[model samples]
Target chain A: MTERYVYMDHSATTAVDRSVLEAMLPYFSEEFGNPNSLHIWGRKARKAVNEAREKVAALVGADASEIIFTGGGSEADNLAIKGAAFARRDKGRHVITTAIEHHAVIDAFHWLEDQGFEVTVLPVDERAMVGISDLESAIRPDTILVSMMYANNEVGTFQPVAEAARICNDRGIIFHVDGVQAAGHIPFNVRDMGIDMLTMSAHKMYGPKGVGGLYIRKGVKIQPIVHGGGQERGLRSGTENTAGIVGFGAAADLASMRFTDGSIEEEVRLRDLLIDSVTSSIEDAYLTGHRTERLPFHASFCIGSLEGESMLLRLDAAGIGASSGSACTSGSLEPSYVLLAMGITHELAHGSLRFSLGKDTTREDIVYVAENLKKIVADLRALSPLWKNRG
Target chain B: MYTEKVMELFMNPKNAGRMEDPDGVGEVGNPRCGDIMKIYIKVKDERIVDISFETFGCASAIASSSMVTEMVKGLTLDEALAISNKDVVNALGGLPPQKIHCSLLAEEGIQAAIEDYRAKRKAGVEAKA
Candidate 1:
């Protein structure tokens, strides 16, 4: 592919690797027996499922039995937040989460709010971090759950999950994390983080889109979010997405293998290349999220006066596949609420672009995107009435 | 590349800032979406003799707001109110579909400012002559 053919929206989703595809293909054909059936074929399927479970467990330092397969990240997140909220509603009515959480956790909390539970949204700093003291002070006698993301999708800021977990654990509040963005890209161990529950989507890694898993620590009680068949230990009731699950396990196994390997360092190097290239080239461009405490695969920034949707469209027209803060929110015409919560103005947020790198990303891709971006920002700013030469 | 005319309006957008404490004021939305345009009118003999605008938005929004001020400068309130968004688009050549809303916002700002003026005029009439 040419320089223009760069794909920078890896945080949104990744292209499935050929190896991951090969690992999952057999399960769709020869190994098609239902894991719940009584026959020998069923037992084989069950054994494969268990092996896959162990792979996922090893990635997160948990027992194989603790992981529950769900349809996707949102469903898993809903099961964790809403299910746990309702199941423990009699015990307490308050749940705490950070302001920068994904919509899955945010919407689930909203649903709980509708059901008469109070939710406190903790604020983030300019670097998009929720302070541990703020979280600790926010906890009350009725606070039942404290859910925060491992890393933000847009800004790439990694929160103090271990610290948040410690606070929640000491206070007896159920701790959970939406680790969809952080699972494959960052080193994650549920036990080390002291998390009671967590959510991850396979698609966030290099796996299929519709498959995800929820980690419910042993003895964590959550009601069934989806009710039908008696599959997934009855927490999730439906025929498993077998092929997708196989692919997910393959992806998890690869991620586990690469955890301490140099892939993450290479990804971080690529991220730095994009960041430095853009910053050194473009004027009045500023980075969002934590400078050091960020995901190796994500970097987001705001260019002066140019709208993110238009920038994304221009970039796509140039053959690069990238998305933006404005394009992501889509209908509201509002700027990124995440950036807004960080005290950046709405206008600046609208002018932002999120450039996320992936497994196949290279230095050449970064240089190409940086060059095109400098040009686009210049052209857009030339037409902006509010744009003035800050340099 | 956008047309030279479109770029002209986008760059030099007339009346592209806010007017402080006019006899009337109008605000359409919170400034998070794109821009918030405020139009200021100075009326003479039931006609908009002098008009200006101050905008807090993107290039398209600022240009449209500026154009709206210029279009209504010497027209009767009735003519000004009849100025449709199509007229603004035609005047600026064309706007992208997303930016068409900016033109509509410009028109809305004009109408809102006029309404505020009329309400004040009504109060003046009820007071004496």
Candidate 2:
């Protein structure tokens, strides 16, 4: 029999779409030209970049001029946090963020702190949802920037984006969001939500890696962190990644189409099916993220007794690809900080598993994974010293 | 990261389970630390006749446990005690630096089990005296 490989690690990264690859192919070879050059070839390349910028902007309902291309999600996050922090330093030296943010945003805040900026890290509830009241109370006259993730990378919990934006707007604080995991999965208009700055990655949404964008709302004052020939309006300097940017544009365009074509709804259905199957069939399994207020295609859990890396290995052997935030997987001594912050015990946190479904996931694949996961969990638990009963 | 031999052992461990009515049992590591290994050994004629392990940890930990048990079975108690963490590591090709601790756990577990068995025999001898 042939091997059955099911990829459910979309949150980590996705397989680039065929259409996106096709769109990017020309720019890599024949159409390859310096976008800054004044020749005809340069003009063609420049036109492609402009069109890509428009497509990326349209994905988030931002104006094309408001979007600045960055190297990747991490770079976009750094640009937003550092750029805004430096620009508004004269106004205030205080910034705010949540405890469940990805390393990109959290480390940026840490760097800002080293540079003399005081940071207020807000706590989240058991479901990993940040409290709006916490945000309201954390805001001070000295607060200049508040960076929070739109959706958690580990648990997929959706933040109180609109409410946080409104609060920041009332306080005249520049609100930045790490939308790396949420951009194309969740539909949101940055302007309507008053989000001053948003970070997005191409690889998370079926685009090629090495390309990302930051949406800076009009009139939002932010300094440029990268210095060079002033490509991407000087916010980012260096030659633009022509082919990668084209791939990102194509991926975003496809995501826009999926949003309208009921494909996203179908993905939600598959996600729910996987969640229900795994949680119901496996004993001592608990869903980690908010059930309703999470990304439609993401499902994470903590299974008791067994560690995450072992589970991932067994699943991979069975041709199911996934990821985990367990200490073993990270090569760290501690389990996932997000789970620990959400009140999960250290023992349970070590058992964390994340399955992020994507456009290619199907019902049969989900069923096969669930069935195999049940057996895997049972088999692993049998070899667990912590497991007392066979069940 | 793990070697091919490590994955082979983890996929199909030589001796993996609990031994009911074992002469000695030893447990090491902690659940909070994300790795715990329990080893059981059956002794006869001063030799380890049977061995089994239950490990709640990453692939390296599981593989280490399996490799240690395979290395010790049918050996004299002294010979089994001489098997070091380095031996377990070498037997499994090699483990990642971060996972070296897992091999140490396997060594400690077997040594603990042997110690337990000796302690039981001493207790019985003292009781008879």
**Whose lDDT is greatest here?**
2
All models, RMSD in angstroms = 6.5, 1.1
Q: What is the TM-score of chain B in candidate 1?
A: 0.89
- Chain A only: list TM-scores of all candidates: 0.97, 0.99
Residues A1-391 of candidate 1: C-alpha lDDT, one tens digit per residue: 2345888898989887787899888888799988888898788788778887888777888898999998899999999998888888889999998899999999989988998999999999999999988998899999999899999988999999999998888888899899999997777789988999989889888988899999999998889978888788899998787888888888898887677779999998888888888877887799999877999989999876667765675676567877677632364677777988999887788778899998898888888888888887776554444566633
| Candidate 1 backbone collisions, by pair | B17-B54, B17-B55, B18-B54, B35-B57
Q: Least accurate stretch of 10 residues (summed lDDT) in model 2 chain A?
A: A1-10
| Standalone chain B TM-score for every prediction | 0.89, 0.97
Best by TM-score: 2
Q: Compute each candidate's TM-score over C-alphas.
A: 0.81, 0.98
Which predicted model would earn the best DockQ?
2
DockQ of all models, two decimals each: 0.18, 0.92
lDDT measured at residue B129 in model 2 versus the true structure, 0 to 100: 100
